[model samples]
Target: MPRTQAGDPLTERTIRVLDAVLDDFGGRRFAVRDWTGRRHDPPGPAEFELILTGPGSLRAMFFPLNDRTFGEAYVTRAIDVEGDLVAAMRVAYTIIETRVPAAVRARQLRLLLTLPRAGTGRPRELRARRGGRAHSVARDRRVNDFHYSRSNDFYRLWLDEWMAYTCGYFRTDADSLDAAQVQKFDLVCRKLRLREGDRLLDVGCGWGGLAIHAARHYGAVVHAVTNSTAQAELAAERVAAAGLAGRCRIELTDFRALDDTRRYDHVSSVGLVEHLGPAVWRTYLAKVWRLLEPGGTLLNHGMTGKAGEPVGSPFLDAYVFPDARLMTIGATVRAAEDAGFEILDVENLRRHYARTIRAWRERLDAAEAEAVALVGDRTVRVYRIYFAGLEHAYRRGRINLHQTLLQKSPAGRTDLPMSREDWYAPPQR
Candidate 1:
């Protein structure tokens, strides 16, 4: 047990301030331990413990008063969470969302102001640098580079064998991550009704997993586009190694800049819509529609928020995704309809995403030493907390994953397939 200020006793005023904050927290299952070895246990069983390292810890975490500030405090080790990180994040999210009385808030602020400010050491990795206007091609490229241009070896430490970064489709909770990823790719192919020599366009293709899979399995010729130079290089290598050089073309270019002369029989955009920002949904969908031939199918897979929830958080925007935004399924469907797309099917894979992220976190934990060697401790910590928080959000219905299928029907003509029987039939060996 560490003592605060050379064994100085905790003041009554300090206890009062802590109590006020915890009272507003209700009956969350967590414990708090402040400096001087004082513990404030919850009314019930605790799933995690938050340790405040010094008298200045609370001030450092709350005085600046924003999610990004608190996040920086945690990353710098002023405040630490032990055991059940997902549960701890749930409580933290609730605290952020809760509103306290004005009088109580003022009193808490006064108490916090009296405490000394803690010294936070330099973090191993700095926060992402912001630049230019949001959603512009230059700005979007910067954001993509910030997240995806990190060393491919670092990502390979935990991602599936194919380096699929998006959600996986699990047949059951017991399915392995690799198996579920394969299932997800096959699912996309079946939804498109891909056939031999059919042309497929993969927008925002990460590492060329789905593109190679489609060419190898369904005999489809695929064109995949990405904005990250790192991803494009690795994907090109993977495509060549898979003997798909003639069938799959990997382009290091923005999806918006694709030539309009080319048209595809099927299009798939997985895990890409979140970065488009809400204002660009109409433009995004219109572009996809233009790239598809009449009677063509398009499958859009991405994360979504609840109907009335806001799209982005300051902490995530600054530390993690930087300008990424989420939209509700209702909003996405409306945008597609407005772009003259006929909705065919909508499926929510929220539960599977929860399992998928949990698996990633576990694998990353097992390879923590290797990850740190690859990307430094600060980057590892950022992703650790991010994956845990995302899993909790999916499990609690705060976020959702949707696979929406749409068709471009010209003259009320849609291609065949009256039933989904073909989707479930076992692949021919």
Candidate 2:
């Protein structure tokens, strides 16, 4: 009960705010509290807890923030989550999707705008220092070292068992990361219509996950190429462990150096193109075109922006992936066509990535005790922020994951008598 006239108005306003949040959250119930709104000095029991306190106390479920602050907190091991990060993200996104009043949204945007931009004088200076050119081999090693040499143990703490550093495709509700990875590998193989006699080339194969899969399951001869020495060595060890020594070979060489006369029936590169940078994107595509046999399929799985040329995130560049850059669909199409490969299909696994990152973050959070011990405080913080930031990017459509399937022409036309590759259920299901 309100004691004063003003108290009633405040109580009514709080209720409205809570209701609005719930409405936006697809009618899912939540217990909300006012840590930001109430309890100035002496924090009450309900101050941090999700419970009602008094007249102005509102109750609704609140999502753990996934903003820049959350990222920083995760990196620092401040906040934690209990279960199903993917579901939590979906709930969070749905709530964010609700249209807030223009005034409120504008105020939030203004605050964001007021934050000091992280820049080196001008964006041009940042771009110029990197000089849109692939410099000497010595210079290139710096970029590779910056990103890839960030400890295999550190990556395994969060990534799948196969050390797959890309978005996973989940099939069933009960599927674990291991299962999703196996399914994703099979999906790619099925998409390429891989057969036992097929000679497969995995471009930028990270730790040889796909190569091992193809060799073991489809009995394909796989040549996995990667520039990272750590990846090559680890991939070889993994292949030998899987008894795939006869069917697969992992090479520590750049795709540019692949000038073999033999062609591949299927070529795939998972989450590798962004490192090629702007200058070599075209050249990279040309190499892929030359590597694939006529009538063969190529799968390029990487991130892309939805609209106009997306600028790189400064925070990500400095703290996460140093030389990584995202491309747009239009640019990818142009590059593939210029390289003489016809685009057969382009699927945006944008939402799937949001879910994937959420799952990864959740897993990382769950194993925090062990992860922090394995990699220390700084590394854990970096990943927490990285995964959350990545989730936000995908959810907001700022960045995306695209699986574009391209095919080289055999009879000057792409039409082939291939069986239906949809024999297995779709990835979304």
Candidate 3:
């Protein structure tokens, strides 16, 4: 490692930038390591350390920096975090909230530019490369493929046995991820009042977990749809292996492409609406309304942005779910109502989602080598930071998980039970 001697220009500039950032943010829980192996300890005990591997690391992270740049730097190894990633993120979030005067930011940019560019190297395939008009079937398919087709085996390493990639309902903090996921599926089924011989549609069913569960347990005839070819293929295998071929079918199609004439007794859109983008919320709700039989239930489950949260982050948009957008619960409900669906119940499971994502992060960390082998280090880093940041966001109430129960009422009638008693009933043996 190169050492920065006294009067070194690079060392002087690095220290100046670091001091400016620390002074503006009051950072005290984390330390920073410069390219010359020089350490700047925080005022308080450090929980994590930000390691700038080269001169360009800071430039790569801070120059033209936005919410996405830090993530990109981490994934490309221009910057690395040692120790608690979540803790590091908390500090970062605090710093982001701190206001810096424009003049100060401009001065920092000047200093950043003077440092040699740490070539980001061949831009690792960190973002989706989909083409076509956003939200169009062709584009949506490409986006979903980019996110879900990475590796089913890789997902299996972290996801529960059911392979659910959504928030799990934890009756208690003691519940295991698998148990909570099972509870979540059951909760949705109960809310929908699923019954034997009913026709069910699961939009954006990931690996057919909920579809198979609903079919096997509730005896519903389930038709699941997804745009990812890999997901559909694996879901078909899971459905068949569960001896549910007669009861469940997984289709490689978009939710928007589903035939409108076919009516379902119940419809479930879990962790899918985020990808619909706010612009298509009405279209999405109306389509689901048309697909439901009279008095049929529709459970729309997904993440909701806080009232004042930014619309979207560049990092997530580019790397995670391309073109995905989150809407507030109020907006979501209004759209459903406008589509002629009456909102029966709305539940916020923000803490549950926080716990769920934390579990995912831990599992991913435990399987770091396998994950890297499966998807390369860059992809793993993307997920690592993403999951950690998501967990933090949920914990802080910046976002929430909403399970909304809606009904396509026939003759202004909802056949729902008198109270919420049934939803909490003990599961039958």
Ranking by lDDT: 3, 1, 2
- Candidate 3 wrongly placed segments (more than 4 Å): 1-9, 96-100, 122-124
Q: What's the residue-level lDDT of 292 in candidate 3?
A: 86
What TM-score, over all chains together, does every model reach?
A: 0.93, 0.71, 0.95
lDDT of 1 by residue, 1-429 (tens): 112233344543454566567566664456677766666666677799888887778777777666666676777778888889898777767656557788877776787888878888535356678689988888888888998988899999899999999989988768899989999999999989999999999999999999999999999999999988899999999999998999999999988899888999999999998888667878888888888999999999999999765567767787789888898999899999989999999999999899999989999999999999998877888788888878988999989999999999986687667988888675775
Pairs that collide in candidate 3 are: 56-118
Estimate, for each residue in 171-247, the C-alpha lDDT of model 3 and write its tens digit. 98699999999999999999988899999999999999999999999999999999999899999999989999999
Which wins on lDDT, candidate 2 or candidate 3?
A: 3
Candidate 2 residues 306-417, lDDT tens each?
6753456544665566667777877887888888888887878888788888788888888888887876666675676567657877887878888888889854676554
Q: Candidate 2's error at 22, in angstroms?
A: 21
Model 2, poorest ten-residue lDDT window? 40-49
Highest lDDT model number: 3
lDDT of 1 at 171: 82
Better of 1 and 3 by lDDT: 3
